[model samples]
Target: MKISILTSLLILLSLAAQTSPVLKIKFDDIESGNIFLINVQKELTDTLSINNGKVTYEAKIAAPTFFYLIVDGYNNTRPLELVLSSQLTEMKFESYKVVGENTVNEAYPNSPIFISDPNNNIAFFEFLSHWKSFYNTIQALSENDSEEQLEKRKNTYHTFLSTNKQIIENNSDQYVSAKMIDFLLNNNLLQFETLQTYYDLLSPKVKESYLGFKIGEKSGKAGQLQPGKPAPEIALVDIQGKKYSLQSLKGKNVILHFWSSSCAPCIKEAPDLLKLQQGNTENLVVINFSLDTDNSKWKKGIERAGIEEMINVCDLQGYNSVTAKSYDVTFIPVYYLIDANGNISLKGTLSQITEKIKEDMP
Candidate 1:
């Protein structure tokens, strides 16, 4: 009877262990204060206060999740945005002063050397560390006239990229790998020709992640619709709530311009765009896709820019707008010129558009 009781107790403890996974955070020098764990998807914030420089939270983590560890410091500067993942069980770091909005000094006093969990999180930090080291080496050799130094720097960069590529390829199934790709893309560290190579290395499961899907969408659309390719269809509603499709403007030379009201370059090019429209009214049609969420802001930008003559459409979904995704419009103030046959003739900056138009028109 005692044996049966013991077996049942062991089973219950095992089940409980399987159900609850604890996230433990330790900051050696941090004062006893409040910290927050914010669910990136749900936007739910769970507050916990430090007790003797440590805190722990337990949850039933069935699947992986991305979270933000927000530390509001005593100095009253910007909050630290430390990204956390469900894969990590414990995190150890030291409180650092904010030097800039997105910068933190890791060399703060009493800060112990730390490393990410090797189970799932280390690849990202490894890539970042190597990249930063390579950058510093290049900077140190910038004024050095020695050919050997330049050659050594080149070899070091090549090796760094190769190692990171292998790391990404090895962890292709993890969401962290996809996040690393996003990091590289935002920093312009990954070359355009190499996008497809890294994308192909990703597992289908990782590709389905939010960041992975964006990378996949970009890779699928990159080098496509360059010249003579049929332009991808864009179906969206204008600010007036009327439906318009990219195919509808087939007969005219269509300029599909992607922009946002907040983009400085887009705003700066307003006069030049107006001039472009005025010069080619009969032969051209400029359709602007505004990746703006707020209807009021889109309306005000249109009014302020005096671009009433152009076809203005806004799905109001910002970066995730269907029209923007269809064109892979990652950067703003991008324009694509489609010929009369609904085929793309050029896709680039405003100046490139001007040059391409001049080259083709004459």
Candidate 2:
């Protein structure tokens, strides 16, 4: 979809000095769309006029040459094959679905292949309408909201970004997915830590969440994770006063979605979750973890919300919930997506939670 808010900071640091190496690139016009080569350390540079859709260039780069490009509206890793003797690099484009003689076995089988033949390529931009709609809503909402309204706005926007992050985490083999995560994290309007936890869980991209980290006392930060981490053990109480641990729910796709009567935002999300639960979402085990402090009120609120028929529990500690502490739960109305393999996939909103369910369902 787009770079996650968590990875944008890393991208910015990697590009700060660009002393990595000197690489000159030129464009060719022998193809159907506009194209150029770029290094991750910097934006695209040295674009040349292409004749008939092809351009050639003489450039110097240290041994491994890798480049990416956005031609028209689609993004791709333009295979950079170095002709050492000629000091020229050849950039080739392929449709995601095109398979070559040497193509590696991958999950994205129908992913694009670089064919000048239009019949062989599917326009990648068409897949992004859902995202564009979400972003447009965030933009419009932001323009009219006041300071207090921003708190409410932040949660919804956070959830939206987390949904895209889940996609990247769910499909780690797709390298471009990480790029999208990076772009989202860099946006100035979003919270850094909320972005990072979602970013860190995907693939082996990086184990660090640089933006949300704190060197001092670390209680209550949404994204501050201990480095080189395993899943934090979380403990919650069932109605019978029996304790349940987050670690115990391994080998299943778990949804640790939080809601509370004290929180107006949390109360508003319950019905949507009820709808998600009814969908029989595949491989998803939703745990409706309540953050309400008063036990009597908590029981009544569930009946009122109509989520009484699902797997629900509470820590009664409210924000001090034991399992919530382990998972670093600062905000109510937030949800965690744990993949079937037990790795954390996402942490965000009910809508985002629903998106992950719809996406991973068979």
Top candidate on lDDT is 1
State the lDDT of candidate 2 residue by residue for 183-249, as single tens digits: 4433322232444455455444222222122211132223444322355666666665656665676
Model 2 misplacement above 4 A = 1-229, 240-243
**Reference-based TM-score of each model:** 0.52, 0.39
Q: Could you tell me the TM-score of candidate 2?
A: 0.39
Query: Model 1, range 124-234, lDDT digits (tens) per residue?
Result: 566666666766676676677476875776677567668888889888888777767776666545543366678888888777766677787565443565577888887
- Backbone N/Cα/C clashes per model: 0, 36
Candidate 1 yields a Cα-based lDDT of 0.70
Give the true-structure RMSD of model 2: 18.0
TM-score of 1: 0.52
Candidate 1 RMSD to the correct structure: 10.4
